[model samples]
Target: MSRILLVYTGGTIGMIKNPETGALTAFNFDELLSNIPELRLLEHKISTVSFEEPVDSSDMDISDYIKLAELIEVHFEDYDGFVVLHGSDTMSYTASAISFMFENLKKPIIFTGSQLPIGDLRTDAKENLITSIQLAGLKERGKTVIREVGLYFEYKLYRANRTTKINAEHFEAFESSNFPPIAESGVNLKINHEKLIKPNLRKKMLVHKSLNDDIMVLKLFPGLSQQTLSYLFKMPHIKGVILETFGSGNAKTDDWFVSLLESLIERGVYIVNVTQCVGGAVHMGKYATSERLKRLGVISGGDMTTEAAVAKMMYLLDKNLGPKVFKTIFETSLRGEMN
Candidate 1:
């Protein structure tokens, strides 16, 4: 039987209803199994490890990323696959970070969670948990079909680095607008084998725990000014910044604004241009407004999600190379995250 590890990092999926308090609270894995006995029926032998003190998704940090990476590294040999129970608020961001952290993975690392507490009768928790594990355990030709980190939610499996939470109340909370869905669930879970990222067998899988968090996402708006642009562009030691601009990567054509970005680029700050729209690619040089940014040394993010771009920027920054050296690295496809 396949051995699957459930790394319970804390989320609504692990919460139980309390009769007296009428509140949801974190419960042990035994409690989860007792409440939802269907877990006993999966094909794989399942085991869980929970955080001593569970963390809310909003509190997630670079340290949490390192912790998640360490858990997978230690259990790599023992488990055929791994499923992470994480809060939905930051699930996409965490998933994206881990995708880059674990390079050339040979096994599945699927992150999943739900909006409602598990103990609620109307909750979305059970199905999300069940399907995630099922996806993790699947294999064919004695090889794991999914060899990268993924975010499984509702009825779809997305490339972990390519997802973004677009809704709060909807069952389908995540979407990969640029990249195609890795898999979709209906009568059966259809794995998009063509889109799945294949591992580099030659490179040994290793985790990069150190993630630089000195980054910010700035949005450009009409009537934006020089002072505001200067303030953000000149942040000290700010290794990277995500510029969310108008359609097709258009930004203000103001000379002062352009000069600010140019100066930042000269200082070696990596600027990544992505669209403000939830679903679209950044087409550099398509319009005059964006020409300044493209000419000012901003790297085109193409159709990458903000979550993916942030994680990718952090990963590239950790390599400690100058921004000029990372020109090819930022735009190049990694983990099927970019267009």
Candidate 2:
């Protein structure tokens, strides 16, 4: 039997109600199997590890990201696949960071959770967990086709690096607008074999534990003042910027605003522009307003989600490449993250 590891962090998927306070809180994974007995039917050796102190996903940070990376690293060789039960709040961010950490990886890391507590009747946790395992362990032509980090929720399995949470109240909390889903489960588990990421078998998976956190995301809005831009550019040691621009990469055309970005680029700051829209590409210079930004040497992020843009920028900057070379690489599409 294939060994599937369940790394249960804190989320609504593992919650129970307190009898006294009548409040929903995280329940023990020891009882998780009972809640989702369908998992026993799968032909896999299941094991679990929970955090010592569970944190709401909103509280997730770089340190927790490192811990999760370390855990996956330590157990990478032994497990056929892994599932992470995480809070929906930052699941996309965590999953995206992990995708960067495990560069050129060749295994499935499926992240999932539920909007409603698993102990509740209407909870979507059971379906998400069961299908994640099935997709993770599936084989094709005597080889595992899916070989990367992914997010499984609401009957969809998406490449983790390409995902972003777009909803809060609905069961469909995650979406991969830039890329097609890896798999989907309806009447039967449907694997998009073509969409699945195949690794470069010649290379071994390299796990990166170090992620430079001195990054900021600036959202471009109408009437965004020069003073605000001035203070941001002056922030100490800010290594990278993900500029969320208007549709098709349109930004303010004012010279002073463009000049600030130009100065920052000269000062060795890596700036990448991603579309603020959920389902579009960044075509810098295609229009008049965005042409100035392109002229300012801002890297076009193409179709990359804001989460992927942030993680990819940090990963490249962590390589310690100077602004000159980093701009070239940041614009290049490594995966299908860009158009």
Candidate 3:
């Protein structure tokens, strides 16, 4: 039987509604089996490890991210696969960071959570949690079917770095518009082998815990004053910027805007151009507006979600790859984050 580890870092999936107060509160995860007895029927040996104090997704920081990565690193060899219970709000960010932190990953790291508390009558937690565990343990011909970080919700399993939280009030809270799901959980679990990341079982997993969070996301919009934009970019601490541009990465071609970005690039602030639209890539030079950004050494985040861009920026900034190499590496798909 496959040995699976359910790492509970706290989220809506672990909460139960109090009968008296009607407030949702975290329950002891040790009684997970009691809460979800269907796990007993699965043929996998499941174990769990939870944070000492549950962290709200909104408050998850770099330290918490490192802690999660270290936990998986410590027990990576002991388990066949891992299922992470994370908050739906920042699950994509955390999962995408984990994907970039691990190298040569040969087993599944499936993240899943629910929109409602686990004890609620109409909770989506049970199916998400149960199926995530099953997917974690799924293998064929003595090899794990999934060999990279994935986020499973509703019925689809998407590559972690390709996902974004699109809905705040729906059961289907996450979507991957840039890429298709690697698997789908229907009557029979369907694995899309064509999309799965090939694994190298001969190599040991390499964990990268060093991350630099000194980055800013500057989303461009009309009526954004030049003085405000200039001041934000001039902040000495920001090492990188994710420039959220209009459709197809178009930005204002005003001399002031272009000059400010050019100055930042010269001053060693790595800038990446990503589209604000949900389902399109950043074709930097396709338009006259973005052509100047391309000329000024701005990297293109082709079809990459902003969550992935942020995580990748933090991960790469720590390496001190300088402006040239950093731009090249950021534009490259090291973890299949960009096309």
TM-score of each: 0.97, 0.96, 0.98
Instruction: Give the number of colliding residue pairs in candidate 1.
Output: 0
Model 2's TM-score against the true structure: 0.96
Q: lDDT of candidate 2 vs native?
A: 0.85
lDDT of 1 by residue, 18-132 (tens): 9899988887785667887888888888988887788999999889888989988998999999999999999989999999998888999999999888888898989998888
Q: In angstroms, how far off is 192's CA in candidate 3?
A: 0.4
- Which candidate gets the maximum lDDT versus the true structure? 3
Q: lDDT tens digits, residues 1-339, model 2?
A: 568889988888879777688799878787767867888898877889888888799999889998999998899899888999899999988998888888788888899988988777777888888888787787766577578889999988998878999999999888887788888888987888787677789988898888887999999888888888899789979988899999999988888988888888888888889999989898988999999887778899988999888878767777878666787887776654565
Q: Which residue pairs in candidate 1 have backbone atoms (N, alpha carbon, C) closer than 3 angstroms, thus clashing?
A: none
lDDT of 3 by residue, 1-339 (tens): 899999999889989999999998997788989988999999999999998998988889889899999999999989999999999999999999999999889889999999999999999999999899999999899878899999999999999999999999999999999899999999999999998898677888789999999889988999989989888987998888999999999999999989999889888888998989999899988989999999999999999999999999989998968778888888899888888
Candidate 2, which segments miss by more than 4 Å at Cα?
A: none
Candidate 1 Cα deviation (angstroms), residue 285: 0.4
Instruction: Give model 1's TM-score versus the native structure.
Output: 0.97
